[model samples]
Each structure stands twice: as C-alpha cells, then as structure tokens.
Target: MRKRLDFLSLNFLRKIEIRYRLINCFILVSLLPLLISGLLAYGETSSATQEKVRVYSMQVVKQISQNLLLRMEKIEDTSEELALSDRLQNLLTDYYGSDEAASAQARSGISKVLLDSYGSFPYVNQKYILDRKRQVIDPQIFAPLANSVARLAEEAPDLNGRPWWTLYNAGHGQRSLAMLREIRFTGNNRSAGLLFVGVRPSYFFRIFEGIDLGYDSSIFIVDANDGAIVVQNRETGPGNADPALQQGIAASLAQKRDADFIAYTGADKMPYYAAIARVPHTSWLVVSATPSDKLNADTRSVRNKILGIGLLCFAVSLLLSAIIARSITQPLKRLVMVMKETESGNSRIRVEQAGSDEIAVLARKFNEMASKLHQNKEQLEDQVAVRTRELERANRKLEALSATDGLTGVANRRRFDEALATELRRAARSNKPLALLMLDVDYFKKYNDRYGHQAGDECLRIVARVLQKSSRRATDLVARYGGEEFIIVVAESDPGGAIQQAENICDAIFELKIPHADSPFGYITASIGVAALQPDDHTAPERVLRIADQALYHAKYQGRNRVVLGSDTVHTL
Candidate 1:
C-alpha cells in the first residue's frame, strides 16, 4: 500500500495536480478583481475629476466672458458716446451746408473728439464716421479702406440702430473687432450717420492679459455667424490655435450659444477641456481650450499605486497558495468547500488551525489570505463611496449653474422652458390656472441706440430684478427670454391676478425713472402680454407661449408700456 501510494503521489505531482490548479486559480482570482477594480477606479476617478475640472473651467469661462463683455461694452460705449456728440451729430446732419469753412471746422472738432476719445485708447486702430452721402468728415481716418465707407455703409447690418460687431483688418494684415452703428439723433430716432471703429488685436490681449487658464491654454473670441476666429491669445501663448481644434470649438459653440466645458482629444493627440460662452449682443463666442493632463494626474497616481500593490500581493498570495495547496491534500475537499464559501461572500469563514504540521500552516495561510482579501474589499467599497459622493457634488453644482442666466442672474431660457413644462404638467394634474407673461422693454432698440448696449444690459438686469421681486409665489419663474425680452411663469394664478402682476411690474419699472429718450413715458417701461390658462392634460406649453407672444405684439401695437391679455379686448393703461 505504501509503494502504491508513493507511485500515485509521484505521478499526480508530475501531472497538473490540484495544487497547481489552486495556485493558478488563486493568482487569477486575486489579481483579476484588483486589476479590474484598479481600472474601474481609475476610470471613475478620472471621469469625476474631469467633470469637476469642467465645472471649474466653465466658471472661469463665465468670468472671463463677463470681463470681455464689460470691456467690449466699454469700447462700444466710448464709440457711441463719441458718435452721439451733439457737435458730431449736428455736423453730420447739415453735412452738405454751403459754408465749407465752418463745416471743415466742425469736422476738425469732431475729429478731435474722436481722437481724444478712441485715440487715447491703446486698442483703437481706425476711427471714422460717415453719412449716407458717402462722405467722411476726416478722409484720412477712412482712407485705409480700399472699398471706402460707402461699401461699409452698404454692407453693414441694420439691426434697428443697434451696433453691428464685425471683423476688420487693422493694418499689417491683423484682423480685429470692429463696431459699425447707425448713429442717430436722440429725438425721433433719425439716422444721422454711421460710426466705424476698428480696434487693434491688442484689444484682445488687453482684456485677456491677466486671465490665467492653466498652462498652455488658448483663449480666443470666435465669430458665431461665420466661425471666424476674431482674435486669439497670440502674444502670450501658442502663436496660432490648431485649425481643426478651432473649427471644432466653433462647431460646438454653434450647437449651443452658451455651453458647459467638455473634454475631448484633439487631432494632435492632446486632450483638452473646451468651454464657450456668448458675448452679449454680439455674434462672438469666448472659447477657452485648456490642456487636460493635469486633470488626470491624481487618478494616474492612484492607479499606479493600486497596480503596484496588486502585483505584489498577487505574487505573494500565489506563492503561498501553491505551498498550502500541495501540503493540504488530506483536507483538500474541506478546503475547497471553504474557498467556495469565501467566494460566495462568506469572508469570515475560517479554516481551523491545529497541530504543529504543514496542514496547520496551510490553514493559517488560507485564513490570512481571506482576511487580506476582505480588507481589500472594504477599501474598494470606501473608494466607491468617495467617488459616488464626488459625482453627487458635481451634479449639484451643474444643476445650479444650468438653471441661471449668466447675464441677469435670473433663470435662463432653458430653465424657463423646463419650469414652464413642469408647471404646465402640474397645472394639468391639478386643473389649476397657469399664467405666462412675455415682457419686453419698450423701445429697447432705441434705448440701446441712445444709451449704448451697456445701459441696455443694466436695464435688463434691473427689469429682471423687478420681475423677480414682483413674484410672490414660490412657483413663479422669471427668466430672460432672449435679447430685451423676458418671460414669467406664474403658477395657480387667474387672468386678473396675472394682469395685476404685469401692471405692478410696469409701475415698478416706471417708478425707477430710468431715463429713455425714445420712450413716450420718458423712462424705461415694459409691455407685458399675459396668457392665463386652466391647463388640461391635453394643453400644450407652446400654444400658451404663442398666445402670450401675440398678446405682447398687440400690446406693443396699442402703443407700448401696457398689459394686454390674450383672450380679452385691449385693456390699455
């Protein structure tokens, strides 16, 4: 029997025995979860980190966008104020006067004013004002253009007296932001002349000088209409942005005028987090492309540590499993049952260690291995919890950011739509009244023309605040609809309540006494159209919007600054 047993053991050892299988299984099972979990942890951490970076980057983009807009508005205001000069306006109004000497003196004075204003600005490259008669007060200022002011006058857009921002060649073949506005007289809104102001590329550098967007970031302003890069950070960063990357950024901005930052690999094999925000009242988008290597550094560090620890543990555990498996043949069945139990999540199940022999040593090894594996499991769970909390935090921030308008600090158009839909659904379920009011600043274009875009923005913000203050209910939503338009959603309000609310808003705006030279009230006023509905399950939000918008049109048609109800006759104030 001893001879037979010895022969069998030798043959079994020569073959691939249970001991070898145990070692292989232990090595594979131990390393596989470590590898998979390390990869998954890396993936999750990277994704979470990227999202946090994106949110942070978007916040930065929003800030720089505000800075750029304020600066651009300052430039525009300077140009408009200079153009609106009573002396300049009078000179251009009587451009064809018989007294050439006086006209020349007036032209010289106007030139002095423009030079004193825009010329003092380090960014101004060209400044000229022209009338419909195709004559420039100062020919030298308009001489650089081969097409002349006539072409500009012809090709320029007429946006109801609002300035048209376009690109211009500021000598030496550098293109820059140019503003062309049909300057008009304060009264009657008559077009007196056109003002053309071209800024140098330094204009971009001036505003973006102190803005830091990490290392090697490219911050640029792009034209939304033509996907033209108006200006980029050339003096400090990369001389020129990659064409494909710029185009991709343009395309992404085109998809949505205001978008959150996103991560993508560039054609150059470099990863970037791109963010975009629209400059108010212009077709320009402020885009920032920041490198993403730093965003992944933390995750890579964690993954490397995990990989090293996992590999070391795998080697040590594999060696111990082979030794334990070979010596514990007598209790292999019981050990296999215990391993199966541990595999099935019974980590506390222990192998009893007894006697001073190899079997006892094997049992101790198994117990130690189980204890270590359980520890790894607990650590992985902690990591998952941390990652989950991080993801939750990011989502909360995103929700807050997405729901507010960047300009007025009110709910944006998207948030407004969502609120309207949600309220409509609630109204449908409860069979309650829901009111939607579309409000517009009376003669806003004229206001912009008179006060410049900066004032217009301030006016909108003031109006938004008033509307926000007027909303007494928690269900009320005030949002900037677009341009100089604002929309309000009042839940559980009747037509009378909604109209009273609109009238209150109008009175509040009127009392503010914000001057408006073009308005009849001589101050900023609102024209509100109220549409109140007892929405059923079948009612559509768009239908309510159309009715309210139509009512708003009628209110403006009935002479502005009044509330008009959708289903009622003209109730003028």
Candidate 2:
C-alpha cells in the first residue's frame, strides 16, 4: 500500500511544464553567476584589445610616414645636386641648338653625368634631361620616357620652376606617378632645361608589408595640395578612400596635425577606426583603417568558449528533464501532432486515451473539442465561400464603373489612353495601319450658354451613342476626351477607312436636327478630323492624335458641319 502511494506521488510530479520548470531552476542556480562573470570579463578584454590595436596602428602609420618623408627629402637633394653640376650647365650652353655631331658629343657627356648621379639613388624609374620644348636630348636611351615627358609637358604647361607630382594614365588600365622639376644653369640662373623623375607607387607602398592591419584593412597616401589620394593598395585603385577618412584627412591637413585617429562607419554599416598621420617635409598624409568586426575578432573566440560551456550545461539539464517528464510529455506530443494535422485541413485526427489519469482526462476533452471544431469549420467555410462570391461580383461591377464614363456612359479618358497605347503596339508589331478621329461639338460653349446644363448633358449622351455606333469593329474605341472633345481610335484601318468613318459620324450628327440658335448651321453639328498612318519602328503614336487635332482646327477654320482629312481636304457629308 505504501509503495503504491509513493508511485502516485511520483506520477503527480511528472507533469511536463512542472518538470521543465524544476530543471530550469536548477540550471539558473548552478550557471547564472558563471555566465554573468564570463560575459563581463569578455567585454573588458575586447575593449582593451581594441585600444591596443588602435594605438599600434597609429604608431605604424607614423613610422611609415616618417620614412617616406626622409626618402623624398633625399631624392630632392640628389636632384638639386645634378641640377647644379658645372658639366651639365656648360654642355647646355655650348652644344644646345648646334650642329648634329657637336650636339651628339655634348649629349654623350651630359648622359654620363646623369647616369652617374642616378646610380646613387635606389628607386628612380627613369631620369631625363629635356630642353625648353620638353624634348629629351637622348631619345635613344628610352623612347617611351621621351614621349611621356612631351605629353606631360603639353598637358601641364605651368609646371615650370616649382616641383610638381603628376599622374600618367597609360591606355589599357595602367597608371603611374612621377616627380617633375625644371633644371637651370648656375651663374645667371638661366633656364637650361627640365628634369624628369618617374617612380611607381608600389615602391612606397611596400613599406607596409610587415604590418597587418587586420582583414579588409587598407592604407592610403593623400596629397594635401588637393584632396587626391596619391597611393593606395585597394583594388579599386588610388583616390578612392572612404569619404569619412577623406574628410578627416582634409581636416587634419587644415589643422596641421602630425597624427590623429578618426572613428567612422564602414561600408557594412558597422563602426570603424582610422589612423591619420602627416608625412613630414612633404604635403602628404598616411591613412589606415579597419572595420570593428575585424578588429574585435580575437574577442569572439573567448565568447564562443563561454557560450559552448553554457550550452553543454543546458543540454545536460534538458536531458534530465525529458527523462522525468516522459510519460506526461509523450501523450502531449501526440496531441500536438494531431493539432498540427487539424491545422493543415485534416480535421479527422483524434488522440487515443489510455488510463484515468490527468493526461487521459485531457485527451478526452481534446477529442470533444476537435469534434466541435470540425463541425464549426464546415459551417464557417460555406459562409466564407458565399461571402467571397459576393465580393467578386461587387469588384467586377466596380471595375466596370471605373472604366466607364460617369456622365455619358462611354469609355473615359483613362480607358482611351490605355486602349490607344495597346493598339499602337499591336499595329507596330503587325506592320498595320492605325487611325485616330477627333470630334468636337461645334460652338459647345455657346450651346451650354443658350441651353441649360441638363440639355447639354443630354446632347452629349446622344453624341456618345452615335460615336459608339460608328465604331464598327470590337477592337475600336470611342472615348470622351474631356469637355466636348471626343476621340475615336481605330486599328487596322487605312486612310480611306478613317475618312469614311469620319464622314459617317458627321452625317449622323447632322441628321439628328437638334436646333442650335447660336450655331452658324442653325442646328447642332460636329467637326470631324481624320488621321491615319502605317505604324513603323520610327513612328510615334502621339503624332497621329496631333495630326487629327490639327485637321479638326482646319475644319473649324473653313466651316462647321464638315469632315476634314489630315491631308487638308474638307468633305461635306
């Protein structure tokens, strides 16, 4: 008897929701503190790591900037030394514009000096001595370099005296930067000629090879005189730095800052940091940046470790809860499956009850509920089908109302525009002729003044009915084109067909014999204009309507109650 009582007690505790609640309580007590502390530590570690990376990136940028400044200064000094040499000055003075052989010997002597001086420098791509016309003396040394110099000189005529950096865009997607300076004689400082120095940006960008600025990180060198990026390793090419970084570099240049950091959003819409530094002895800036996701990659591993341990604890707890709650949960799981089937339109499914326990009682209640729901659903579906049918009929009526004229019961202006566009396309595709007929009630304003508005409305209705009857084919349409103007669009119609239809419409309106005291005809009449054309690839649909309108004006100008062809023929119907 006591064992049976204990069994009942255990069964009472096996309810699924209750069992899971107990397991969750155990987990919260055991792992909550560990998780809280782990997350806090992770945050602190990530912040410190980011700060370190920011400082290190700035330092590396400044170091590279300084090295570049020193190299450029050395290069300038070498150029000055070559410019001041006595041999070059004497060669220029004695042999310039002389005979070919004399000039040859002087050129040979100057070339030797240039070669000797250039050997002292490590990164010179090409060096040349040019005349005032920017012609290289020894074209045989490098013909391409000579041509590039001539083109550069022609493009930048003002680059004489002061040092200048310029870009050369070679065809087939290639470019390079070069330094140019004019060489003058020593004594009177007379302009002897020019010197050309070419260097590839890759030579300077190689300095960043030893450092890693994280994934998707890039470095750029910007020219201060203009907001031009002089060098960048990005695949998009130079002068394409992020706008925020560009703005920050511009600000730094304006403020004359040596080094600084800027924070901005990256292309991914995530926060990013950049380090900016000025290269001394030159108007250049070094900028480096990386997205925050890449910068914080190291901290993510720590987070994954903490999360893995927490998930393992959760899995163990969930396993124990499932074991304890199996009896109650198993039946509930079947009930859930049945409920899903019912939701998917299978209303015949029901749970099987086994014992007189709480689960069994619940199963009985669910079966009864499912039976009632099936009956109610059938009645609801019938009512919904009826409602949907009524709605469809109402919508069709609304569409007809929208497309029909409210006053005259003809096609409205919107329907006319749609039909005209459709017919134009069809005619062009089929290489057929299309026609447009525009009609206007003669002296419509005067008619409205003499007759009442109700009489005017009735007259318009009569005209609409006559126009509708005149449209012989189902594909043709007559539409009220606002006020007393009406349009009739006909497809597959020739010029003769259009003129015949216009004549018919004019005769029918005149036969009505409605009295018009103010009209010149002594009765109501309409002027009809007919325009027709064979639609081709080059034909515009609007041109036909404009022609018809012009013809209508011509008809009115000649006399009322007549049909006018666009070819300027006035026909009395």
Candidate 3:
C-alpha cells in the first residue's frame, strides 16, 4: 500500500506538491476578494459622487433657466407697457402733423422719454419706435445701429405682419434679443408705428456668473428652434469645443426637447455628461457639460492603490493563505447565493452577516444601491404620470376650443354639423320632430361699413348672446352658421313652435337696441327662417339645411326683421 500511494502522489504532484498547490490556490482565490472589494468600494463611491454632481448640475441649470425666463418676462412686460402707453401713442399720432416746431418738440420729448425708460432698465441696450412714414422716432439716440436697423428692415419689409421676437446676432458684436410690437391707435385700433425693444446678449447669459463650474466644464444657451448657439463659455475655457460637436449637440437637443440630460462625446475625444433645461415660454435651451474622466478620477485612484496592495499581498500571503482562504470561501459562496437571488428579480434580497469583513461591507453597499435604484424608478414613474395628465387636460381644452367660434364664443360650423347629424339620427329613431332656424342680421354689410369691423364684431357678439340665452333647452343648440348668420336647432318642436322661437329670438335682438343706422329699422334686428322635419332614414340632412337657408332668404325678401316658415310653400309671419 505504501508503494501504491507514493506512485499516485508523485503523479499528482509532478509540478508541485499537494500542500504547495493548496497554498497557491488559496492565494489565487484571495486575489479575487481583494479585487472585488476594491471594485465595489470604488463603484459605490464613484456612483454616489457622480449622482451628486449630476443633481447639482441640474439645479444650476434649472435656476439659470428660471432667472433668464424672469428677465425675459420683465422685458416683455416693458414692451407691452410701451405698446399701450398713451404718451407714446400721442407722440406717434402727431408725428406727421403740419407744424414743424411741434413736430421737433414731440420728437425731443419722445427721445427723452425713450432714453429715460431705456436707461431705467440697465439690462436693455436699445429701444426704437418707427412710425408709419418709415422714419425712426429717435434717430439721434439710435444712430449707432442704423445700418443694422436698415438691414433688418430690408430683410423683412413686412414687420407689421410678422413681428420679430427672437435673438439677432449680427456680427461685429451687435448681438441682441429683440421684441417687436405694433403700436395701434386707441380709438380706431389702426396700426400707427412699431415698437422695438432689445437687450444685449449678456443680459440673458449673465445667469452663469459666479457659478462654480469645474475646470474645463462649459455652459451655453441654445436656440431650440434653429439649433443655434446663443451663448457659450467656450472662449474662457480650453478651446476643445469643435464646431461639429456643438452642431451635433444643438441638433440633438433641438430634436429631443423633452429630455433633461444627454450624454455625448466631445471634440477632445472625451465622454461628457450634459444637463439641459429649456427656458419657460421661450424657444431657448440652457446646457451644462462635465467631463467623464474628472467624474471617474477618484475611482481610478482607488483602483490603482488596490492593484498595488493586491500584488504585494499575492506574494506575502502565499505561505499562510490556505487556512485564511477557507474562511472567506464559505462567506463568498453565501454572498453569491444572495446575489443570484437579487439577479432573479428579487431586488429586496440581502445578505445576513456581521463584523467588518469585506463581504459584510459589500452586502450593506449592495442593499443601499438597490434602495436608491428603486426610489429613482418610482420618481421617474411619478413624473411620467404627471406629464401624461397635463397632456390629457391640454387635449381636452383644444377640443373645446376647436368646437367653438373664435369671435362670437358660440358653437362653430363644425359643431353645428355634428349636432345636426346627431339630432337627425335621434329624431329618426324616436320619430320626433326636429326644427332648424337660420338667422341673418339685417344689412350687416352696411353696419360693418358704418361702424368699422371692430364694432361690427361687438354687435355680432351681442346678438349671439341673446340667441344663446333664448335657446335654453337641454336639447337646443345655437351655432354660428356663416358670416352674419346663425343656426338654432330645437329638438322635438313643430313648425308653429319653431316660428315662435325664431320670433322670440328676433325680438330679443331688437330689445338689446344695438344701433344699425343703415337698416330701415332703427334698432338691430335678425331675420329668421324656420324649417321643421320628422327625419326618416331616407331623407338627407343637407336637405333640411337647404330648406332653412331658402326660408331665410324669403324672410329677407319679404322685408327684413320677420320670421318666415318653409314647407311645401313658404309663408311669412
């Protein structure tokens, strides 16, 4: 038996003996623990640090967005006040009068007022008021930018139609964000002049002042509409931003207006993390960037130290490693089981252990990471839910507005068609009568010519309110059928009832006593036509509409301000 055992041991220990082999295996196994410990510690610390940096960057970007938005809103309010200012309106009104001395005085007074107002706002760099004669109201004060103004006017001759409300970066440091408004007469609402308000680019980009941006980090403002770089701190830092990188980032952000953060590679061939935010009520973006190498510096330091110590321990622990390695092997097996459980969708799983061993520290850190991940997921879901609700509410409001008229605040033609089709179907099902009345204001063209379009709109609104108030049935619908005409559909009403309803609507308009001087009648009145039908499946809905329209013409022909009924024969009331 001794001879057989010696032979077997010799074969097994050809390269090394069993004891030496066990020690070597132990040292190899121990290296894994050290490696894992260093990696886990570095990963936890690095992840935490990066998360903090990202959160801080987001806060900074959001604050900048809000500050810039507030500044813009202030400028916008000033523009509004200037547009409606009576003094400025009077200045423009008397600008072209025949008195040269008064005109000079008015120009002087206007320039002084603009200078005072513009000086009061330290942020505003320029202001201009151009009258209808294409003359600057204050040319002496704004002569420095005369070429730019002329170029702008040449580029857009129709400034009255499409007001410029964005940043303009004409080279030679003449960059400004402008708000253009049209000045109108208070009495006639006629365009008198143009009001131009502008503030330097520094006014918007000043939010970055005193911010503790890390070395080599950059912050910029981007135009969301055209992907243009509005402001940037690239010149102050290392010149690593290439035009391609900027263009790529701007294009990406312009397309993805919803994302708050995005990752990209910079021109320096380094990975970067960017935090982005949009200015409220404006098409602009605020972005900040940090290098990934800086974020991972501590991890690299820790890893290098662990590698040095690990190599030294590999040689030092070779002799006593066999015994020490057994102790950790069992614990590592248990940790592996716990990790497998977590890997199988059991994120709540945790290792049960005590003492300051590496395994114990790893278990605690793992549990912490799991908890944080879960919290972040829940927060993301909550934000998604909030955004979805906002979209749904916005859609509902759009639907309501689309179904109503812009001028009269009543149901529009689209809503009328839908109501008419639905009522026809319901009446056909139940065999009940449906009555439609078409109403037209008498001599509306003459009324519009006499009082102007603004007053004519008011007159239509008053008539609409009266019609809407008179048709107060649950199933009754009043809609603006066409220009200066309205349609009222009364469910379950006969011809007599329909004519009486129409007469009541006409009398209601008369009682309002809106003056229509061109009409033969001294007061505003409506001519209405009534058409009743018991809808059958074969009868077309448009036929009833046509009959009602023809009856309205008959009412107008039989002298306005009367109700006409349509059936086999038309009759006047």
Could you say which candidate leads in TM-score? 1
Model 1 stretches astray by more than 4 angstroms: 1-30, 141-150, 236-257, 261-273, 291-298, 309-573
What is candidate 1's lDDT per residue for 426-516, written digit by digit as tens?
Answer: 9999888999999999889779879999998999999999999999888899999888999999999998888888999999999999998
Model 3 per-residue lDDT at 213: 62
Q: Report, for every candidate in turn, its global Cα lDDT versus the true structure.
A: 0.76, 0.76, 0.73
Q: What are the per-residue Cα lDDT tens digits for candidate 2 across 1-573?
A: 645543433454443345365576466556666678678878987989778878988998898787777766666777777778787887887657567777777876676567666633435656778888878877345466578777886665555466666665543355566767788877887788887776666667666667677757777777765656777755456555566666777776678678988888755678878888987645677888877887777787777787667755664566444444555566678889988998998878989886556667888998898889978987999999999999999999999999989999999989998898888888999999999999999987679879988899999999999999998899999999878989999989998888899988888998999999998888889998888888776666567776787688667756767878886766666
Question: Residue by residue across 161-225, what tens digits does model 3's lDDT show?
Answer: 33456666544545667766667888788888777777767666567778876835678877655
lDDT of residue 42 for candidate 1:
95
Worst 10 residues of 2 by lDDT: 8-17
Overall local distance difference test of candidate 3: 0.73
| Weakest 10 consecutive residues of candidate 1 by summed lDDT | 6-15
Superposed Cα deviation of residue 529, candidate 2 (Å):
89
Winner on TM-score between 1 and 3 is 1
Model 2, backbone clash pairs (residues 3+ apart or across chains), number: 0
